[model samples]
Target: MLFSLFSEFNRVDAEDILGINADAAILVDAETGRVLYEKNSDQVLGIASMTKMMTEYLLLEAIKEGSVTWDQEYSMSSYVYNVSQDYDLSNVPLKRNGTYTIQELYEAMTIYSANGATIAIAETIAGSELNFVKMMTEKANELGLKDFKFVNSTGLNNSDLINHIDDGQQLVGEDQEENVMSARTTANLAYHLLKDFPEVLETTSIPVKIFREGTDDEIEMENWNWMFPELAMKHGTPAYKGVDGLKTGTTPFAGACFTSTASRDGNRYITVVMNAKGGDPRAARFDETKKMLDYAFNNFSKEEIFPEHYQVKSNKTLSINKGKEDQVKVYTKEAVELVSKKNEKENYQPVLVLDKKLLNDEGELTAPVKKGDKVGYMTLESKDGESIEFLDGSSLKVDVIAAENVEKANWFVLSMRAIGGFFSDVWGSIASTVKGWF
Candidate 1:
C-alpha cells in the first residue's frame, strides 16, 4: 500500500545499486506513525527470530495482565530442556530443575537471543508453550498483524517438526508455515510496542553487559544490533544521536532481518529490513538501518501539529462527581507532531470534531472525570477534506472535566440573594424618582 500519509522525499536507490539484497524494507516516524521510506515493504517474507518481537510483546502483555511478574521464578520444562540440548545452539543453559526470575530469563531471551530461555519464559507465563503460541497468534490478529504466525516460541525447525501431522491442517510447523511478516507490519508492531512499553529498549539497547549471580559464572551479553557502533564512529562518539535499541534476526530460510528504533529530542523512528543478503545479517541490518536513520534525521524536523493548551473549538466543560472540587479540567494528552516539508505551514491546518454523544443532551456535562478522560475527539483534516497525512488520520482524544465549578446554590443562599435583589431594586427606584423631581 502506498503510504501517502506523509509527504514523499527524494528516493534513494543505493540499496539497489549497492546490491543490498533485502526483499523488504520500511522506515517510519515513531511518534507520528508516518511512513517516511519504503522498498517492497508489503511483500511477505520470513523474518527469523525477529519473531521475538511478538514473543517479547506477549510477555509484556502477560505481565500487564498480572499473569507474570519480573521477580517470579519458574521451573524449566522438558520441551525447553530438549531445545537446549542442541550443543551448537546458542542456549542460555537453563537447567531443568533450576529456576530463574522472569527478569533474568527475559534478559537471556532478548540480549543473548537464547531460544531455550524464550521457550521457558513462554511456558512459565502461559502454562505451556503451545498455549502461549495460541495467545501469540490471537494477539497478532488483534493487533492487525496480517502476515504472521507463531507455531513455536523459539522459532526453531517447525517446518520439519510439523510435516508429520496428518490432520491436513496447515500446522504452523510445516514448510507451509514460513512465519511471514511484511517489513511495514513488522516495523509497525515494534514501533507500537516500544512506544508503549519503553522498558524493552532499556534491555535491548545495552551495548554490552554481564549477567551473573554472586559466586556463579558470569555470562557476557552484547547488543547484537550494530548500528550503535557504526553511528558512533561515523558521527564521532554517541553517533546516530538518539539511536538505540531493537533486535536483529537471521536463519537460512529467513535470510537476514532487523527492526531498529531510535529517538532524539522526543522524536522517535523505527526502521525494518527483511531478507537482506550478506555474510553477517546483523551487520547488514546495521548498515541499512544507519542509512535510513541518516536519511530521516538529516531531512526532517519534528513540527508540532497542535500547541499545548491551544483551546480546541467545541471543547465542552465536564462535571465532577464527589470530587473535592465540583469540576475538573482536561486537555489533549500531548501535542501531535508531523514531519512536513522544510517550510509548509501553509499546508498545515488542524480541525476538531467532538463526539457529541459523550455530552448530555441538555448540553451539561456529567462526570467522575480525570484530566485525560476521553471526553471527545478532534480530527485534523486537510482543507480539501482529505485527511492530513503526517497525523496518520487518527482522531486526537480530548479530556472531560469542568474547566471550573459553579459554586453551590442553596435555600438560605437564595433568600440572601433575594434580599440583595430587593435592595438593588429599591435603590434604583429612589434614584429615578429623585431625578424626575429635579
Candidate 2:
C-alpha cells in the first residue's frame, strides 16, 4: 500500500549489495517503492514486535473511521495485565481493571513496543486479538504482501503467552503461530504506514516518554529503534543521525529485525534488515542499514528527465497538423525524474514513438490540435549500466501534449501549402534529373 504515483524501482548490482550483515535485507526509496537493494528479501520469518506496526495501522484506521477516538478510554483486561508481567516480552505493565485512554496506550505500544498495550487496543477495536490478527492478514493480502501472516496483535511467538490469540492459531509447518513476513513485505508495509499516517512518527521518534504520567503507575519508556537520533548518537556514528522513525524487533525466532527510515538532504530511504548475525545483532542491523544508506546517499541521486513545458529541447518533437500555424510545439505533460548512480543519465535516454496518423507524409502533424491534447507519449529508458539499476520498464514516461492550440487554416492557405510542397518536391526531382544528365 505504499502509494506511488510513479512505478519506478532503483535496483542495484548484486555485487553492490555484497557483505550486508543480515540474512534478509532490502533498501527502498520510500516514496516510489524503488527497491535499491535486497538479499533473501522474500523469505518469510517471525517478525516479532514489527507486528505491532499492523496493530498500530489498524488502530489508526479505526480512529480515522470514527469507530474509536484517542480520547476514548478502555479498562485493562485481565489477559493484558497478565501478559504485561512477562518480562520475556517487551511490555509496559497494565493495571488490571485500570483505565487508560487510547492515546496513552497507543504511545505505550508504539514507543515501548509494549505487548500488553497492543493487545488491549486490538481487543478494543476488533473485539478480540484473534480477530484483529485476522484483520492484519487481510490487510496484508490487500497490500499484495505474499506469504505474510499474523497470528497475534503482538509479535510474540510463545503460544503460552495466550494473551493475544485466544483461538489457538497455528501455521501448517510451524509448531506455534508467530506473525511472519518477508523483508520485502515488511518494508512495503512500513512505507505505506509512514505515507498514510506520518503522525505515527511523532510517537515512534520519541526516545523517552512517560505513559500514565503523574500517576503512581507512571512508567518511563524508551524506543528500541537505534536509528533514531538519540539512540544513533549512542552508536557514536554521526551518519546514523537522520533516521527519525521506525520499529525494531528481536526474538529468538526472528533474531533481529529493523524496518528503518531515514531522511537527509530531502532524500529519504527505508531499509529492512532481518536475522542479522553478530553477538550484538541489534547493532548488526544498524550497521547493515548504514552501508546501504551510505551507498545511496553518496552514489545515487535524482535527476529531472526533462525538455518540458511544450518545448522540445531534445530530438523528440510534436508534429503539427492541418492548422494555420502548421505544427505546434509539444513536450512532456508531467515533470518526472530518474534516479541512478551519478552520471548514469548518459545512458538514460528517451524514445518518441508518436501515432503516425497524427503525422503527414513529411512526418509533420496535421494540426487543428488543441492545447494539452495527447498526441503521443515519450517512453524514457536507461540502458543497463555497470553499477546502478535504473527502474525497469518505462520508469519515466510522459504524455507528449500539444503546447498550443492551432486553428484550422483557410482553403487558400491550405492550397498554398500543398502547392508549395508539390513544387518543392518537383524541384528536388528536377535537380536530381539534371545531375544525372551532367
Candidate 3:
C-alpha cells in the first residue's frame, strides 16, 4: 500500500539550508536501493531514540515469523514498571502484574513512542531486555547494518551496570562510548523493514489514535512526529504528499535525529538525519525532509528500463536432452524500472548476457525445458554501474518444444537409399514418357 509520484521538476540544493547541521543524512530510493542524496552518510553518531525503529523491526519480524501474535498477552515486571515510573519521555502507564496484549504494546510503542511499552515488548519477545539487545544486534548484522550497534532496546544511555568491566576496573566518563549508527545504515535498516513489512506503517502513520480493552480506559496516543500535519501545512508544498509514518529523536548528546519515508507514483524514499543541533528538532527534521523530498521529486524519475513483453535477442533455446520436449523458448520475467535523472534519457541502454553452459554449441535451443524455467537472466546497466533486472514484468514462460524424434542413419545406409531413390526416379521418368506417347 505504498506509492510514489513520478514527475520531473527543478532540483533544489538542500545543503545550502540553515539550521541543518546534522552529522549525517541520506536519501535513498526504497524500491531500487538507489542513494538519491547524502552527506556524511556513513559517519557513526548518537541517534537517540530512533533506536526504537529497530525495536519495531524486530517486533514485526517476530510477528511475521509466528513467534508472537497481536492478541497475545504479557505482564510487566517490576523492572519494567520502575523504568516506566522514572522515564518522562513516553509511557503506557503499565503497572507491574498488569496484562496487555502484544497489539496494545506495539501501538503504544510505535504511535506513542512509549519507552515503557517498548521495554515490555522487548522483554516479551526475547524473554529479557539483554537478550532483546542481542537479538537487535544480530538482526542489524543480518540486514547488513555495518555501522550500527545496539546495547539497549530503547536507545537510552545504558546504566553503568550494563557497561563492560576491564580487569575488575569499571570504565567511566570519556572512556565509555555508547551504541551508535550511521545515517546510511539506519536508513537502510528502515528501508528494508518498511519495504518488507508495510503493515508496520499502518500503526506508525497514525498521528492520533486510541487503544483500549472493554471496560478499560481508552489510551489516547498521539504521534510525536510533527511532519505529518504540522509541517505539511507550514511548508505548503505538494512535494510533502505521500510522506508518512516514521520516528523522530532528540537528546543533549544525540542532538536531533529522524528517519522518514515517503512515496509518490510508486517510488518510495527514506531520509535520515542524525545529530542535528536546534532548539526544536522536529521542526528542523521537517524542514530538512521537505528539502530532500523536493529535491528527489524534482530531479529524479522512475522509467521502465525494459519494455513489457520485451524479446531478448540471440537467446539460445534450451533443449531437453532426454525429455519429451526438445527445445524451450526462454525470455525475461518482467520489465525493469530505473530511477534516472530527468534529462538523461540518452544514457540508458539494455545489455543482455547468457550463461554459456545453458545453451548448446550450435546456438540452438536446449530441450528438457518447462514453462517458467529460468534459462538465463539479463542486466539492464546504465552508463554507470546503476543496473536493474531486465524483462521481469509478468512471468514469461519458455514456449518452445523439442523435436519429436531424432533422424538417425549410417553413412552406408544413406548411400544405399540415395542410389535406390535415383534408380526409382529414372524408371518413373521412362514410364511417364511412354504413357505420353501412347
Candidate 4:
C-alpha cells in the first residue's frame, strides 16, 4: 500500500470554480499537461476547421523530415479550384492550373481557415485528400487521443464537400461526415503539436500577411484568431494579454470552436472552446476562453513545496545488511514544484516507496549500496483526501535516492561478528531460563 495513496484520493472537480457557456471546453497547462478546468470535455462533437490543426502538424513534420518544402509549388486540381471559388466558405481564390507555393497555401489555411488551401496541403503530403484523412486518423491514435474521428484534412462537413462539385464529380467520399473529437482529445493533439514543433508559432502568430502581395492575384489575409491584440483592437475590444498562435473552427454543424494558447509570467496554457452559444458564435468562443484563462492566472502560482534532499520525518534512514554500515539516508532527488492554490500547502503530505529488489526478507538493503542510487520514488497525497488528477494519468512525484555509499564487509569481519553474536545469545538464553525458574 506504499503507493496506494496516489489512487485512493477522491478526485475533486474544479468545474464550479468558473462558469463557461460552451458545449465542450478544456483548459490545460501547456508544459505539464495538467487539467486546470473542464466542462463536458470528453464529449465528441464536430470540430469544424479545428481539424486543420492536425493538417498543420503533419505538414510541419513532413517539412522537418525533408519530405516537403515551403517553396514547393502545388498545381490546383479541378476539385480544389471549385472549392476555392466558393466565397460562402472561408478561402482565397485559386486559379485553374495555377500553382502556388506551399508557404502561400499554408498561410491561407492557418490565417484564414481556407478550405482549398488546407486540402492542397493535405494532398501534397499524402497525395490525395482521402489518403491524408487516413494519416490524420493514424496520427490521432499515435498521439493517445481517445475520442476522435477524422474524415478529411479540412474540417468542413461532408455535406459541404458533397455539395461542392466539379464536372459532375463528388468532392468527398460516399459517407457524409466531418471531423469529430472531444475537447480533451483536441487539447491532447494541441499538446503534442506544440511539444513536437514549437516553431509553428512563428507562422501561426502572424496577425496579417498578404498572399502574392503587389501582384494581380494578391489577397489580404487576416488571422481569424480575434483574441490576438491586433485583431481585438480592430474589433474595438480589449486584447487578452499574451494571447498568441492557434486555430479557430466554425460551421453550422460544429457551431464555433477555437483552440488557443496564451502565456504570462513564464507559465503557458492551452484552452479549447467548442460550440459556444451566442448570436455571434465567433465572439462567444473567445468570451468563454477568457473566463477559463482568468481563472488559471488568478488562482494558480508555482511554488516549491518541498526542497531538494528532503527526507521523510517518520523514516529518516533505511536499514542495510551485509555492509560496513548499518543504514543509509534517503532523500528526494530534486525539488517538487506544483502550480497550486495560494493556501493549499497545508493539505499535502509526502509518501515514500522503497524498491523491493534492494531489500531482503528483513526489509533491509544488501549492500554495497552506492551513493545516489535510486531507492524508489516519493509521491504526494492530499490530507483532505481530495486531489486534482493529472490529465495523463500520472502522479505528481519525484525519485528518492540513497545519500551515500555502504561498502560490503570482509569475510574475517563477518566471521568475528557471527562468533561474538553466538556467545552473546548463549548467555542471554541461560540468563532468561534462570530468571523464569526463580
Best by lDDT: 4
Residue-by-residue lDDT tens digits, candidate 3, 287-338: 7877787788888888765654455565434444433444555556666556
Per-residue alpha-carbon lDDT of model 1 for 111-170, expressed as tens digits? 877777887788787777667888888887777665555677765556533432332223
What overall lDDT, based on C-alpha atoms, would model 2 receive against the true structure?
Answer: 0.75
Query: Where does the lowest 10-residue lDDT sum fall in candidate 4?
Result: 1-10
Which portions of model 3 show Cα errors greater than 4 Å? Answer: 1-20, 160-177, 210-220, 230-239, 309-331, 356-375, 384-438
Clashes of 4: 0
- The models' CA-based lDDT, in order, is 0.66, 0.75, 0.67, 0.83
Off by over 4 Å in 2: 1-13, 16-18, 158-160, 163-175, 232-239, 310-315, 319-328, 353-368, 386-394, 407-438
Q: Which stretches of candidate 4 lie over 4 Å from their true place?
A: 1-15, 163-174, 236-238, 417-435
TM per model? Answer: 0.68, 0.80, 0.71, 0.90
| Reference-based TM-score, model 3 | 0.71
Query: Residue 83 of model 2: what lDDT?
Result: 83
Using lDDT as the measure, what is the rank order of every candidate, best first?
Answer: 4, 2, 3, 1
Q: In angstroms, give how far residue 146 of model 2 lies from its true place.
A: 3.5
lDDT of 2 by residue, 144-263 (tens): 666576667788875647544334433222346567777777888898788788888788878888878899778889888776666667864333767876888888888888888888
